[model samples]
Target: MKKLNIVFMGTPEFAVTILDTLYKSTEVNVVACITAPDKPAGRGQKINQSAVKQYTLEHDIPCLQPTNLKDENFIGNLKAINADLFVVVAFRMLPEVVWSMPPKGTINLHGSLLPQYRGAAPINWAVINGEKETGVTTFFIEKEIDTGMVIEREAIAIGENETAGELHDRLMHLGAKLTLQSVLKISSGEFEAIDQSQLTEEELKPAPKIFKPDCAINFDWDVQQIHNFVRGMSPYPTAWFTMHNTKADNNKTFKVFKTTLHSSKANEVPALIELDGKLILALRTGSLEIHEIQMEGKKRLTAQQFMQGYRPEEWEITL
Candidate 1:
């Protein structure tokens, strides 16, 4: 069997996992890697190499960090590889000249099932929308983002209280396995690609990039909605809210990391409450018991720790 020569492109930890799988496969030869350029990061401004780049360096794989994909030199270097196919995971959008250069063309591993939740931040959006199930998709790369023909898909159920970070870990491994399978099928030329338009008729949901403002918790929403929002953003761009301090006459921001819903019909004015030694955020339809939180300018703490010096009676959540 001829091992398929592939050029892997991605930058993040998720991409690194997929790249590792391909690198270890007997049927695949990862000839080269294309990842983001190393840049100074953090308060100290230390140079940081991308996860994929680090892997490639450790394994001695030829790596390219092109500041401009369209540059003649970069294009010439990529063409020199003469790889059979290109494999993309969590990478930036590729130009036509780059993706179309390989003979077998490029295939991308997407976080969500094709034709649904098609965009960046698919994992976060699926959990925020309270999806019961979600999965990964491998498809051929096309002109439009995530609009390519599907080569493979593997579904997984979403836990009711699972955070987006947790779900991301599960999908990362699942995606790696499916990607290997897709590569083998392509290597043997035994699989048929299906058009995205023929997959489903339901309205497609877009997973646009999330910003800080998008992570703000809306107390007016139902308990389930608020709960979903908190978990969906937990551990990154965490869900947050503002509260007015009566004693200090100031507003403080609270970043919520963990929350559990208590559902019931209620017209109570949303506010912070302490009941049975637990900190709860009252809402329109119900309340959420905050398990983990970080106050503005304060370190993250448990509900008990947050309640030590803070009195719920002196604070009211800003609607």
Candidate 2:
């Protein structure tokens, strides 16, 4: 059995797991890696290396970071690799030339069960919509984004309290294992491709990209919906709101990192903070027991720590 020459493209930490798995596989030869160009990040605004680039460098794998996917030089270099197959995980949209380069064709490891959630930010959208289950899928790359022939899929149950961050880690490893399985099957010409269009249309749910506005907490909604929204955006561009501390004599905004729900009366109004003791806010359905929070122009701190310097009367959260 001949080892398949593979070209892997990805950018974030989620994508690194798959790349690492492929590197250790005996039946797959990763000829090279493609990642997005380095961009300035953090407080100091220094040029930062992408997760995929870091992994590739550590493993001594050739990496290409192109500003434009269709650049002639970049395309030429990719062609030079002459790989047998192309694998993409958490990467940007590819031009036809790139996806069509490999003889065995390119495949992507999407975070969601396909035909549904067939767009960017699937993990977040899944949690936001209060889904009970979600999974990963490996499919051949077609002209339409995420609308491809499915190669393999494995569903995982979503915990009620699970945040997007937790789900991301789970799927990252799951995707890695699934990708390896798909690659091995493809190499042996034993894998079957199922057209994504054949999946039931009635069950489809779109997973479009989320923006800053999408991250804002809507207290008017039900407790379950609010809870899901918070979890879905946890640990990244976190769900946030303006908090005013009347006792402190200033209006301060804080980012909510961790929160738990508490039961409330039926007639209670949404977003109403029944109790504002310390850093906790009581909502109609339940109270948001803030665990970790970050204040404007200040470092992240625990609820008790934030309360120490904050006055309940002076600061009030604006819904």
Candidate 3:
């Protein structure tokens, strides 16, 4: 049986796992990798290699970091590899010239089920929308972003208290398995590619890129909504809010990473409340027990640790 010649393209840690799986697979030959160019990052601004690039280096695979995807020279080099297919994950949008180069076409592993959550931050949006289930999809890369022909999909249940960071890790592994399966099916010419338009007619929910302003916590929403918002953004670009600390005589930013929802409202109480050493945020219809939080310029702390140093009565969420 002839092995499929694959060119892998991705940049982040999530992409690295899939790249590793494909590299080790007996059925596919990862001929080369195309990841983001090395750039300076962090406070000291040291040059940083993408996780996929680092993996390629350690494994002695051919790697290409092209500044411009459409550059003729890069295209020339890519064509020289004569790869059968391109596998893309967590990478930048590909120009048609690049995605159309491979003989068997480019396949992308998206973080969400197709025809839904089709955008940049699918994993985060699914959690924010309080979804009970989400999954990974493998599809052929077309002209439009994420609007590709579906090849395979694998669903997973989203936990009630699961954070977006946790969901990301789960989907990362699920995507790798799904991608490998899709590649094998495609290699054997036994896969079916379904059009997105045929999937569903319901209204689509987009997963747009999240910004700092989007991460601001809104206590006006109900408890469940607030809880979902916090969980969706936790551990990275965490959900936050402004609070007035009367005892400290200052307004501080509080980043909330974990919370539990309660339906009973805290009637006639301030937004920030404490009961039995627990820090809770009272909302309009319900309350949220904040389990993990971090004050500005301070390390993250549990609810007990947070209440030890400050009085909840002196703090009120700044609307």
Candidate 4:
């Protein structure tokens, strides 16, 4: 039984888990790591290594950070590794040259169960859509992103009010476990890759990348929809809105981190409302009580704490 030669491609902490597991496995030889190039990050603009790069370096694993995946030089180096299988997690879409290089085909561990959530930000979109359950999927990479045939899937319930950050961590670990299982099964030569098209049990849902406008808070939405939106974007690309003061001060943007939904009858014209000595943003049918928030150029604070220092006066939700 020869050990499987593996090359892992990934970028974030989520991807590190999959690469790390294969690296530690005795049945496989993790020859090299391919990750995103180090780029200027943070306020100091220092070159920051990706999570995958940091992990590989710490473990003394060989790594390649190709600025362009199609570079012949990078491709040549990859061919030298002569890997049996390539595993992808939380990584960019691969060029066919890279994915097809491995004999056993490239394996991808996705954050959501596919054919559903088949795009960049599956975990976030799942929570944003108010899904009650979501899980990880391991598949064989093909030309289309995340449309690869399914190797295996493990379902996990999404917490009722879990933020995307929370669900991401959960799926990260779960993806690692499933990916390991898939590798071992592949090594044993006793598995079948199920085409995602065969799974007609659930209607397909797309989890496209979320942009700036997608995270904007729309007060006209119902309470539950807004609640899901807030939680989905929390702790990253946070759901935000512009605030205009009565004094005609420069409008500031505030990111909503946490909130509590309060249902009520017809609200009073959908404006900021005071109830039980708390600041609640009125919506079409209910109120959204912001639990934690961060204003531009200001530290995070609870709604109560923020109110003590500032007054809405004539402040209103601005576009």
State which candidate has the highest lDDT: 1
What are the runs in model 4 whose C-alpha is more than 4 Å off?
263-266, 312-314
Model 1 regions lying over 4 Å from their true place: 263-267
State the local distance difference test value for candidate 1: 0.92
Question: lDDT value for candidate 4?
Answer: 0.86
Candidates ranked by lDDT: 1, 3, 4, 2
Q: Please list all clashing residue pairs in model 3, or write none if there are none.
A: none
Global lDDT of each candidate: 0.92, 0.85, 0.91, 0.86
Off by over 4 Å in 2: 43-45, 248-250, 264-279
lDDT of 2 by residue, 1-319 (tens): 9899999999999999999999999889998999989999999999999999999888899999999999999999999889999999989999898898889999999999998899998999999899999999999998999998999999999998888999999999999999999999999999899998786567789998888887888778777787788888888868877765655556666677777675444335433232545445556666656677788799988877777765444555576
